[model samples]
Target: MNVLLGLSASNGIGIGKAFVVPESEKRVISSKKIKAEDKPKQLERFERSLAKVTGQIASQLDAVKGDKVQSEIFETYFLMLNDPEFLGDVRKSFEASNHSIEYILNQKTEDYADRLRSSGNAYLSERAEDICDIFGRVLNDLLDFHPFDIEQVPDDAVIIAKSMAPSDTVILSKRRIAGIALTDGGVSSHVGILARNYGIPAVFDIENILDEIKTDALVIVDGTSGEVIESPDGVALSYYQNKITKAKEHADKLKVFRDKPAKSADGESFQLMANIGTVDEARVAMEEGADGIGLFRTEFLFMSEANHAMGAVHSKVAAFSEENQFNAYKRVLETMRGKPVTIRTLDAGGDKIISSLDVQHSSSEEKNPLMGLRAIRLTLANPSLLRTQLRALYRASVFGNLKIMIPLVTSVEQVEEVLAFAEKVRDELKSENIPFDENVPIGVMIETAAAAMISDCLAKVSDFFSIGTNDLTQYTIGVDRENALVAPLYDEFHLAVLRLLHKTIKAAEAEGIPVSVCGEMASRTESVMVLAGMGVRTLSMSPKLITSVKELLSKMSIDELKAISSKRLNSL
Candidate 1:
């Protein structure tokens, strides 16, 4: 048997015939050099070529029988082909180079690939390869050669690629292929994540997997251990077969917790909510028995190039909370609807800055972005962005239990500013005869020492408090979480951090504002009891952690938690 060997790298299982786009053949052409007169013709030619290539890929995907993966893969490619940025880049390059459409496209792809390969950053290098692969496939379609259709691959063939994009990986049929081996990719790449989600055995960043592994090789991929055995002996094959079986069984067991209530053993209940970024995730959260969405990051809505929030924004937001049986906000008006979905409005700044907003706001690379204006500070500075978000939230409120929570509030004044802006937006909506819940409660995320220290004052003014322990710990300990040298000092369990948390919880309790811990610490079993003892009633975390946290909660009591909280406070 032809043997293929490479590290089990990506996040999934299954395989297909590899579609390799040679990186050396890629070229980049500068867009600035093209004469203005030739721009329109070049763009027209580029667009036609793109459409033709997309059509060819679509046709090939349609020819594949019973291959669900292949279908998803082509669909994503279609999305990318239609993406404004991709098309715009082609046009820009054509305009600058004053070259023929093919030359411009080829040069652009090559330039991108070359820059990526030469970059010191490994992640950028892999991303560059994905770009080349995508454009190369498009180019191949335009050139009349179908780049290795999925229907052409024999069943049980393993795909070998110089690199794979996440979108490309998603389209492969999971049942047909044995596994995947990449010549280049990283653990954090989109392809890797998609692989994990699909439970397909994958290995990435294998230095020469493509060179070593031939087509139709019966290579054994050990995803759990990141190992690949070439033409494995009977002993290794048997071991992997057993492992695959066990993994499937374990997955089934995890699914059992889906519909069950996430209550602790001692009958003390803590809300288990999902942190989601999209409407798709919201559906998954409901299926997973999430009490509500703990965090619906709104940045995803603003990801498009358009400054205006999309037209479907309200409908999309409503879908998450409205029409659901356990809508928390309606059940407990003070909280959010069917399992309250607490939303932090556009927490941009730091690494989350978008280029579009940066250009409008004239945001330069800050010497210390972490310490600079960000989150609430940035929003407060640009009231227009803040107002737009408030309007969207107000419009979305009529659909379900929607609560607004402000991030990085360092003082009472900041809280006042956000509230003032929110109230202003509410009034405008009312004047416009728009329906909105005027009493929709607002909360503050206790992420900074300033916010934590004055939690009592903030609690009195706000409806609730969510302890953002991740930033709280980092800010209190005066250590950057991303700084490798001082990362060890970014401990959540530090006495100062613990004390601040205890103080914030006490302040919230004194003011009678319900408190929840909605950070990474909420997922930690060791920290749960302490948070519970500190009188925190809710914990919001990733959906994957819900069942495990529920299992832990089922074993603890409020009284015990309170005692632990007291002990920690006294010792501190």
Candidate 2:
């Protein structure tokens, strides 16, 4: 047996026959010179191929309708197909080249993908993969060849791929594939996120496994440990089989904690909440027994192509309108059944560039987007957009408990501005005879260094505080979490970040307002202990992590957590 070690992405175990997915990037295309007079016919052929690929994506979208995240991903494929700039470049290339449409299209798309890969931005780099996926689909249509069909993949078979696009992951998820092992992906890649959301076992960064392992070989994927056992002998197979049985038993045990109230051994009660990005995830939060929805990322409402978030600024399709946002927010609030739902306003820009909002910036790249106009800065500049979201939120408030949390709040002035605008929205709704919770609380996200330093001032005006450890660590440590060169330095446990967390929590406590940690740090055991010890009673994270964190909380007393927190603060 040959064992391979890689990064553990999704936690689970799977034993099945290996199915090697074909790599579209390896396709060979030979240039066929075309006459200038035949340019019209060539362009028509390209249009036909584009249409066919678009139809396939639409079908995929129909299959995964309720999954807002997956549906949006497929919609992005539509936008990529209809991207005016890319299409213009293709036309220009066709005019300049004597080669076939396939050759020119491939060359231009590769150039675009290469530029994105070298952009030093993780979000854009992933978009490069999406671009390649779109290109492959179109090329397949043009060449009239279908090498692999995902639906034909055997049920519960382990999928082995060099790399998987978001669309491929969505399709494979429907079949309930046994597991996924990839040579190119990480914990935060789009495919990785999908695998976790779908509750599938996944291992990433398994270099050269595709070359060594053959199709239909018996494979054991231990996603919890990032181990892939190929052609295991009798002993190893028996051992893994036992492990799988125990894992199933452990999962069954976890269900007991699902409906239990979150409390420590010392009788210290806490709120275990879920951070969700879609209405569907809010339902998951309920299923996972989350006390509330801690961080409701509203960007998906705008980022989804169906919402016209990706169209041109003046596209006939409007962006996430007041009605669209209201229905989405109302559904999530109702799903929680009166449980508190903290919804953050549209946090576009930075890594998330909403095409409709920043048409100019999307065309002309920004050198330092993360630190540039983003979050509150971007929304405040576009008052109509921010006001529209506020109107929708307040209109949906009557459905259930709701709190508005503003992202990247660097100043008390910013907090006051949002509060003022929100009041005006409520007033307008009241004048129009619309019902809403007049006392809906507005909160601040302690994500920036400035926000943490001035937390006390912010707490005086804000209703509550939610520490976004991801951005707080990035801003405090002056490191981009996605940059491989500096990722090791982007420590969430850094002394400065912990101190900031403590400071923010203290500030909120002094003001008699609630404080919470809603980041990846909150999902980890050790980090949860430290945060709880630091006076954070509300810990919000992924829905899948809630039960595990609740179980850990139940095992430790308040005193033990305080001691752990003290040691971490003093040493690290």
Candidate 3:
């Protein structure tokens, strides 16, 4: 068995023949400068290509009317294509350098992309891909290159590619492909977002993948674990097939609990909702019987130009006005149609910074973004930026059950400041006669040890608590999960993290406020039980994991889980 490990972009099981999607190099064939007189003609050619791409984007919007995620993808491209800075900068470069349109476009975009890539913010760096995507399509159009059509791909074939554009995923999804594996692409990429939208099994970031797997080989993709198997023997095939069967059976069984309350065997009940980044994911969560959206990652609205879905983006929101932010919240609120949606404010810093918002621009140069001013700290430091989002959320709250959450909070002072700012927005809305939710829920994310330690204080002033285990584990244990060499040291159920969780949950329960486990940890069956045992009555995770998690919750006894927790705690 040839085993390949990658990042799970989407979840599912699939077995199919590998259909390699060949990648073509995109580059300017001619770099020679045009004469002064030919500059106008070159400029005209550039405008025509831009117009064509614009038309294509408009058509996509028309085709996909209400798919906000997909619509945002095209809309960002349209924005980039028509962005005055981008267009004007490229034109200036051509005028000065007299370079070919392809050369000028490539050079200017790369220059902008380089700034973003070197911003030291991981999520912001990913926007380099967006810049490349927008300009690369225009480059291809200018060169008269006819790209491969997704419609021509074989049906039910596993798509193997080095990388995929959002459009490629969009078009190929309609072709009924079995799965997708990419040597390039992050779980936060636009294509990754589309994969989740269509429920396609996808794994990405597998290095040297094309050279490892051959075409026509039977491959088994376990998207949840990010494992892809090539030419599995009889035993392995049976194992994967049985696993698939069991998963489906499990899902079907959980369907009975769709309308049922999440009450434990001992009569302890919990709020089970979905953690989503986009509006479509909210719809999926509702279909999977989620009570409400426990975690609505509003970061996707800011990073729409980059990866575009499933929030938790530690990056910057640039050139995004109050109207832009307001419309994003309204779109999501409209989609949820009154289901409770918790919107986490910008968690910028430590690898997530909006270069534009970074007044000092010092954050983009920070060696350690994870430990730097991020989340609440970043928002507090930039009150105007915070107000921009607060106003939007406050305005959009009237459309649905909206709750605003502050992320990476470590102090009551920060919570107080945020609340004051929120109150200011509410007052302004009222004064302006703008319709808004005056009593929208205000919450704090219990991610850092400081925040978890003082949960009682935060709970006193907060309406709810969401435990962000992904960061809690990393920070409490002093391990950067992103560092490959030290990733193995990271453990979600570590004693330190468990202790923090126990304290926070108890504090929230004491205050009579709802506490939720909204991290990836809440998705696992064992972790879910442990969380419930620790007194966490609300759990939020990805939409896809809802059925399985609910299924496991339905089978387990809270009292027994508490017993296990006691035993483990005693041992620890």
Candidate 4:
């Protein structure tokens, strides 16, 4: 028996025969110079190959149109394929350097991918895979080579790969795969997100995993524990089999809470909401017995519209149009069926870069972008961006309960600025005979230390407070969580961060405004208890974690949670 431990990406147990993905044969591009007159023909060939790959990716997009994350990833391929700026650079290179199109394409794509990989942001680094995947398809088409055929992957096989791109991951999701084991993938990678969404057991960052696991070998992947056992003995295999059974049983038991309201042992009811990025997730939240959506991250809607679809490359609207935003928000609102949806207006820039936003200060220009123009700052600077979103949101508000939340709000002035802009939008809509909800609530996200510190004043202007611990932890601790060198120090449990959470909740409660946690910390079982004890009555997290959190809260009285929270706050 061989056991290997890796980062647990998804929670589940998967036992199946290993199906190691075979590496494709490396292409040998001829570096010989071509005639200058041949440039037009080479460009034509490149366009043809690009067209073919674009068609392939479109088909993939259609297959996953229901899944927002999958579709967003596939849409990025369209952006890369149709990016005039990048393609123009490639064309210039083709004209200047009389090299083969394949060589030029390979070199250019690698250069961009390398730059992104070295950007120090894990999300951007993962996007490097998308660049290579799309360009690789184009290169393959140019070379008349077919990549790994997903059709041959047998059902219930444990897929082992050095690394996986979203392209391969999307296709593999259709199968009844036992699990995924990767030597190169981060917990925040798109592949990892897809795995968790699909409820597939996945373990990533297993060093030299492909070499250790052979094809058809009996493998047990314990994603909950980040354990991989290959060729396990009967005793080990039996142990994992029992674990799998118990896990399934536990999942089945959680289903009972689907229709039950979240309440404490002492009968105090609490709001258990879901933090979602797309309309599809809203439907999932309902199915998961969520009270409402606490955080509807609007940045995703902007990200999905990157480069403005396939054929409409240079559309007049750099980001999602009012109509596009309206339809998306409307769909989510309609899906929730009158449930309160707190939609945070575009939290773009910073780590969540939306190229479509066309911010004047790009990450390349800013030395430290995380604290630079992002969220409320970006939207406030560009009134048109926030105006378009506010119009769509208010327009969609008529469909259901809507609460507008501004992100990265540092002071009451930022909230006032957004309110001022929103008023202008409302007046314009009224004059235009557009119907919208006039009483939609506007809230502020307590993500920065500045916001949390002045929550008492912010509560005077804001409708409610949503604690975004993900950013709050990093900001309060002065550490970038995405930075591997300093991520360990970015702890939500730190005394400072806990104090901020406590402060935010207390301030909101004092002002008679609801306070909720909608960050990664809310998704944690222990963190939920701490927050509930700290006087937060609402907790929003991932849809998949709702039942477990609900279950945890059901067993613990408010007093018990308060004790736990007090102990942690006083000690830690």
The better-scoring model by lDDT among 1 and 4 is: 4
Candidate 2 structure quality by residue, lDDT tens digits, 406-498: 999998889889888998998899899999999998999999899999999999998999999999999998998776568779888899999
Per-residue lDDT of model 4, residues 460-522, tens digit only: 999988989988988888887755567678788999899888888889889999888899888
**RMSD (Å) per prediction:** 7.2, 2.6, 5.0, 2.1
- What TM-score against the true fold does each predicted structure earn? 0.69, 0.93, 0.82, 0.95
Candidate 1: C-alpha RMSD to true structure equals 7.2
User: What overall lDDT goes with each candidate model?
Assistant: 0.64, 0.85, 0.78, 0.85
What lDDT does candidate 1 reach at residue 23? 35
Lowest summed lDDT window (length 10), candidate 3: 307-316
Candidate 1 lDDT, 1-572, residue by residue in tens: 23444445553334334433333433343335556686676566566777676676556555652333344344434444555655677777666655566666777777766765564334445546656767876665444444444344445656566765543553444345566667766654666655665556787656766566665455766565666556667776676678778766866776777777766557766677777654456666676677887777665444422212122221012112222312322332223335577778777665354433332441223545567767887877767667777776777677777778898888888888788888888889888998887877899889989898888788878998888898888778888654435656788888888988988888987888878888988988879878877777788887766776776777777777778777777876
For candidate 4, the lDDT comes to 0.85
Instruction: Please tell me which model should have the higher TM-score, number 3 or number 4.
Output: 4
Models sorted by lDDT, best on top: 4, 2, 3, 1
Instruction: Provide the lDDT at 186 for model 2.
Output: 61
- Per-residue lDDT of 420 in model 2: 87
The total number of steric clashes, by the backbone 3 Å criterion, in model 4 comes to 0
User: Best-fitting candidate, measured by TM-score?
Assistant: 4
Better of 1 and 4 by TM-score: 4
Residues forming the 10-long window of minimal summed lDDT in candidate 1: 312-321
